[model samples]
Target: MDDIYIILVASLFSISCGLLGSFLILRRMAMVGDAISHAVLPGIVIAFLISGSRDSFEMIIGAALLGLITSFLIEFFHKKANLQTDAAIGVTFTWLFALGIILISVFAGQVDLDQECVLYGEIAYVPLDLWITDAGLNMGPKALYVSAFILAAVIIFLSFGYRYLHITTFDSAFAASIGISIGLWHYLLMGMVSMTTVAAFDSVGAILVVALFVVPAATSYLLTRKLKSMLLMTVLLSFLNSFLGYYLASTINGSISGAIASTSGVFFLLAFLFSPIDGIWIKAIKRNFDKSKNTSKTKFNKIFKE
Candidate 1:
């Protein structure tokens, strides 16, 4: 696959993950995405057993369903067992992840499962795969094409349900009072998240999907108060980070997903230090400048009185 195609696919996948993750972060459910990402492993294993192949479509469906199950289990423990939400998520994910590991270990030589491959995903070979055939161009890296479609699907859904999604993102209680069906929205959001993360698993790996999901969106939220502005900025930042990070990784012989995550980390750090509204340096500088102005005003008044 062409290098440009790789960049395009990475951008599409990263942006899709980031957009869905914005809501997760707003609802304080960012870690839920992480939990679902890891817990889906057992689902993948089961899917392999039942389907007899690691088909992308089957894996996606299986992972999404398992993600919903993870959500239900978390809710169950939180509501019925009176467990803390974070603790519930942590427990559920690790146990499932461990079960997946055990399954792989037990059937090591018998099946097509690798623990590192499962955890890290396979982004490097995305360009070599052919998803589209019979065009003037090879239309390389079918993963990019598929991911772009996924991103478009998310955008369309969000567009059509903008008002309801907005209300739910800001305040679920208020959304429910207004007949928005917060429960439905919650499932819908999780479903999209599940799809995006699973799609990303082919290229960016599981760990970086978590990074891509949260960091760009969090940075955008910190940089802008308006949701629209945040969304636009997040998309742009995600694209740029994917392209530049991939180029850097290729040039330096480093992990592409890790490079992208580190690049996003740098972006978050920039937002933390430079965002005008809530940035640490911005606040500190404004405080010192305000103090200086007040001191100058007081000195001027004293001089006039003298």
Candidate 2:
């Protein structure tokens, strides 16, 4: 039963990350997910310090706020300081992440978080944190509920704002020409990323959360060009990772989060190898076939001329 709950929780996190990650990948901002996930560490630490309690609401609010700040800082560095986008992201996230480590070490006795857990996560312990009602009703894991809510929010926002998201993603100038506020939509998207990252950070940690966000979406993108197909494929792949990773971890007595991340990477490798349109090996084979055909046509032409 505990294993089942853990898988369910992981599934929710995977689905939520996949849905939002599709947009991030399309916008060529896939690394922003990585940036935000790591940058939120300081926010989590600060929230813990202020509240002195690990309440979900406080943690989420703090992380989400910092996610927005991280986005703003990245933009500021890129535009104001003339730094490259990647450099800006690297600078901002590294600073916050370092700060978070310092805070954790300083408050080692008070805080329960560990550097190791932030890096890889202890998802096996997720099942232990059950959410019980005052009536003594078993309400499953709190992580499950939080992840499910974030998943629903992502679906609803994407469903309604599909046009805006699609336009802004492929053509920000066009979106602006049509009177869309690109900045507004961008920050809104970042907010979603922040909340999703914070929610999954507990179960998967900062490093692995980036995998869940980017890998499935990236694999799906390689497999298909259409947005709808990519989104559907991403969700399906997330579920596959969650279930298969859980079983694999159980069989090997390894880290569940690590196994799940590995599963996502495996799917990505398969897609990269076999995708019909853009796969590296497929392109190589096609080029070889074309060369052979051309060579045969040249030989036939010479023979006919002779």
Model 1 reaches what TM-score against the true structure?
0.90
What are the runs in model 2 whose C-alpha is more than 4 Å off?
A: 297-306
Question: Which number leads on lDDT?
Answer: 2
**TM-score, each model?**
0.90, 0.95
Q: List, residue by residue over 45-65, the lDDT tens digit for candidate 2.
A: 888888786646888899999
List the candidate 1 regions with Cα displacement exceeding 4 Å.
109-111, 132-139, 293-306
Instruction: Choose the strongest candidate by TM-score.
Output: 2
lDDT of 1 by residue, 4-56 (tens): 77778889998898888888898899999999888888877777777776546
Which lDDT value does model 2 have at 127? 76
RMSD of each: 2.9, 1.8
